[model samples]
Target: WVINIVRFYKVYCDVEPKRQALSKANADLAVAQDKLVNIKAKIAHLNENLVKLTAKFETATSDKLKCQQAAEATASTISLANRLVGGLVSENVRWAEAVRDFKQQKSALCGDVLLITAFVSYLGYFTKKYRQDL
Candidate 1:
């Protein structure tokens, strides 16, 4: 009976250590599981943030494209406007030259009209003087 008691005590001692080790291992596993859960949550949050950032990037890209197109269109419009201004300037020069020519012709015609008027008056005076003498 003493031997049996000794044997049982030895078994109990071994089992006690094993049980304590198992408990500690379980506690460590629990800590590892909690860490894993936290990491997964963080990954999910990061993924959500990534999705939002990606959408923003896409929107920014689209806006950049639109702005680029607008800038190009504006540049072309300015180019056309400049061409039109050049054409208008040329037209203005032509019109000014025409006006100058017309003015010169008008001056020449005015001198001719004055000479003709004086000749007609002289003829009329001679007719009256001759009739008086007759």
Candidate 2:
């Protein structure tokens, strides 16, 4: 009975440490499960934000494309206006040069007529003087 009691006590001591180790492992498992739950919640929240950000990014891209199209249209309109203005300026310059050339020709013709008339008058006076002297 004495030997049996000592063996029993030794067995009990070994079982106690096993039980404590099991309990510690169980506690660690519970803490790990809690951490996993929190991490899952964070992942869910991050997924929701990612969805929202994707939608916002699409909207921004659409708006940017529309703005670029509008800018291109404006640039085309300005280019057309510039071309028209250039054509009009060129036409006006041509008209001004033509008018200047016409005025110069008219002045030259007038000068030629005046010289012819003076020469005719002098010729008539000299012919009358020659006839009277003869």
Tell me the tens digit of each residue's lDDT in model 1 across 18-80.
999999999999999999999999999999999999999999999999999999999999999
Error of 2 at 37 (Å): 0.5
lDDT of each: 0.93, 0.93
Writing each residue's lDDT as its tens digit, candidate 2 over 1-134 gives 99999999999899999999999999999999999999999999999999999999999999999999999999999999999999999899999999999998897987888998987776776777684664
Q: Considering summed lDDT, which 10 consecutive residues are worst modelled in model 1?
A: 125-134
Worst-scoring 10-residue span by lDDT in model 2: 125-134
In model 2, what is the error at residue 10, expressed in angstroms? 3.0
